[model samples]
Target: MSKLFSITLSLLLLFQSFNLDMIDVAQLDDFLIHAQFHKQKYGDNLFVFISKHYGELKTQHDLEHREEQKDHEELPFNHQTCSHFSAAFVLSGADFTIPKTPQLADTLSNFFYQESYCHMENSDIFQPPKVA
Candidate 1:
């Protein structure tokens, strides 16, 4: 196989391993509800990272729909958004404690951001574009 083909095949297999098809509307809804609970309990900054990324996902989806000549309706959540939200939820802890202070909230936000960043950095699908 050519080097480019080999690399593409490896990346495709790595992406398939993520099993994004397992995400469903029901699961996404549940995550949103839980996110709302966390937002209220832990304050807005607690989920700042997830919310920012969610907005980006929405924008991308809108652009995609526009390109396809379709009306843009808000999607509940896609695999990428679901995965990010799930990661943030777990990083924040399954057994939740409301962060009572700004410092605590900041700490949680930082943790979520760092974890998500590292995950993307390590993923073949998220690698930075190569320079010519």
Candidate 2:
């Protein structure tokens, strides 16, 4: 095989191994509900995707701490933001969906990059120059 093809095959195997602990269907349903809420509240400003439950907890906690420190004297937390579980959003539709595994991060990032480019009228970011 060519070097590029070998590299691609290696990456595919790595990703498959990484996604072993995929979120269950029920977890996905819950995540979808929460993601929908986030979308409605934050509009297009937020990125929706599945993340490791433990990984996001630390992040969520840090955000809370920052908010609390910002209001030093006040109680700070008036609402709950983090959930006990983790999930991935069904990007294309309700029926066809995949777990939000770490392996999908690169793909999701690329999709979002393209989407942002479209909104900014700069879709050329991913395009190649036309042949003469």
Candidate 3:
């Protein structure tokens, strides 16, 4: 009976952990959606654009010895796009689907943290490169 109780307790703990992981994935999905919406409506504000375009800004500053004023180039949807305000406006309905759970992101982040020995990793191999 003690053995059975231990097994049941372990299973319950496992199930609770699994549920929490699912919640994290849901939160990540929500974050991606929020990013998409802000990009659509605000054209990537200061902070978001800073994070997204950090690479380019760094490179530009390195080459020119000056700070980059903006994060991204204006997309067709961002301004007057021939007949439309911007494509992001129309594309706003699309969902940002995360292929893996939030655990994946955390696991990957941790892996990179350990593997790179801190900032020794390449952004291109781990994350997306600058657009322009």
The lDDT values for all models are: 0.52, 0.47, 0.51
TM-score of each: 0.22, 0.24, 0.20
In TM-score terms, candidate 2 sits at 0.24
Kindly indicate the candidate among 1 and 2 with the higher lDDT. 1
lDDT for 101 (candidate 3): 44
For 9-79, candidate 2 gives per-residue lDDT tens digits of 99879865654223332355555554465457545222332221223543664465564343222221222
lDDT over C-alpha atoms for residue 123 of model 1: 83
Report the Cα lDDT for residue 73, model 3.
Answer: 26
The 10-residue segment with the lowest total lDDT in model 3: 72-81
For model 2, the local distance difference test gives 0.47
Supply the TM-score for candidate 1.
0.22
